[model samples]
Target: MTRTVTLCEVGPRDGLQMARGRMATGTKLRWIGQLAAAGLKEIEVGSFVSPRAIPQMADTGEVVRGALAIKGLTVCALACNLKGAIAAHEAGAHVLAIPISVSDTHSHANVNKGTDAQVEMVRSIVDWVRAQPRPMRIDAATATAFGCSMEGDVPLDRVVQVAAALAATGVDRIALADTVGYAHPALVRDTVRAVQDAIGDRLHKLHLHDTLGLGLANALAGLEQGIREFDSCLAGLGGCPFAPGASGNIVTEDLAFMLESMGHRTGIDLPALLAARALLRESLPDEPMRSGVAAAGIPRTFHPAALAA
Candidate 1:
């Protein structure tokens, strides 16, 4: 049997949040629909953050409502605090992701709180979500888990400490994020192993970046460590506006192609996934979109793992 990997599309939320211009809510919804149609089971539609903080995601509530209309699509949203989590819940988001940066400086810059404070906030958010009538999944994404550009080398022990704290908070899952793209293959392996030892199965996903062009390599390392879920952006669009020099996320098209070619079942249609780039091109005309598979085009002999099965 072939192993299956889950790719959570984060273009609409993480990708667009860093975009220079705002994408209309309607366009975002259509792009999300296209992604879902291409067999993406989960998508981070938008962040329930203050409009003043990120104007691009101001209409997240509306986007969540629209995304709920699509059957079998798990709509996920980002929330840094309890207020944002409440708003996401009210909007009917199936999953709420709260980023807790391991670097104290980066944490303050990104979410205006220290790492310990953010952990407590996550605890509070988890409590509130459980008290609510509707059941929603909560994910605590540990940003800068590999390293931090602002604070320099973040010790591995600190990463495990934060993950353990988050696990104790009762979050359904924990995702390790290479927030500034400083991770290499070895670091990826070691970090995942360390976090797993600390939090066990709670470390379920990886959020990587391609700043130094090693995104795919690091992802391969994560795969070797038994991480099944990953966070990627369509067209390789996204960066941390708060984290200096952080750039493009792992490209969805390239990742899907790589996984399928390697006999890992991703369940994503390559042709349709490439076609969805048109929406971004047409909407964000000035934004640069990067993709290795898109540039070379799909090979004739290519076979996806789903078909191989």
Candidate 2:
């Protein structure tokens, strides 16, 4: 039996957050439904943040509610603080992802809090969730775990420290993010190992960016280190508005293809996944979509692990 790799589609949340124009609530729901149909089990539906801050995510509550109705899909939402996490819980999100930057400068710029403060916020959020009657999984991402655009060369020890802190907070899982895409394959391997040593199985996912075109390479390194979950955007839609020079995330279609071709089970329908990209194209025509597989169609001899099994 082949190992199953979990791919969490973050296009609706991370992808749209950086889009030039806001995607309508109905359109976003439709695109998300299409992605779920394409066999993406987990999807970050939207972020629960102040509309004034990121007007694009104003409809996150509605999006999360709509996504909850999708059967067999794990609906995830991004929350920057305790208030956002409460909103996500009220909207019936199955998972709440909180990002804590490892770089102090980027942390202040992104969340107006230092790295230590964000870690405390995560602990508070976890305590609040435990008190609630309803259960919602929490995931904390150590952003800029690779390197930061504002503060270059975020030390690997700092990344492990942040991960250990988040894990100590009792969050269900932690993800390492290459927020500015400054990571190479070696960095990914070393960082994953160090964080795993501190947090063990708590570090399960990698959120990589393609700024330096090493996104896939970095992911491959993570796979070698026994990391199974990844965060990707359809049509490669995402970038940090706060982090300068940050590019879009690793393409969902390409990542799925790569994983499937490598005999790992992602349960994604490549052809169907590619077809889902149409909604983004029509909805955000001016938002340049990126994908290597989308440009050159699937190979004739291609075989997915799921289908083979």
Per-prediction TM-score, please? Answer: 0.99, 0.99
Q: Write the per-residue lDDT of candidate 2 for residues 1-309, one digit (tens) a residue.
A: 578999999999889998998799999999999999999999999999889888999999999999988999999999999999999999999999999999999999988999999999999999999999999999999999999999889988888888999999999999999998899999999999999999999999999999999999999999999999999999998999999899999999999999998899998999999999888999998998999899989988789998787
Candidate 1 segments exceeding 4 Å error? none
Clash number for each model: 0, 0
Q: Give the TM-score of candidate 1.
A: 0.99
Encode model 1's per-residue lDDT on 15-92: one tens digit a residue: 999998889989999999999999899999999888998999999999999999999999999999999999999999
lDDT (C-alpha, whole model) for all candidates = 0.94, 0.94
Query: What's the residue-level lDDT of 142 in candidate 2?
Result: 94
Instruction: Looking at model 2, report the run of 10 residues with the lowest lDDT sum.
Output: 300-309
Looking at model 1, which ten-residue stretch has the lowest summed lDDT? 258-267
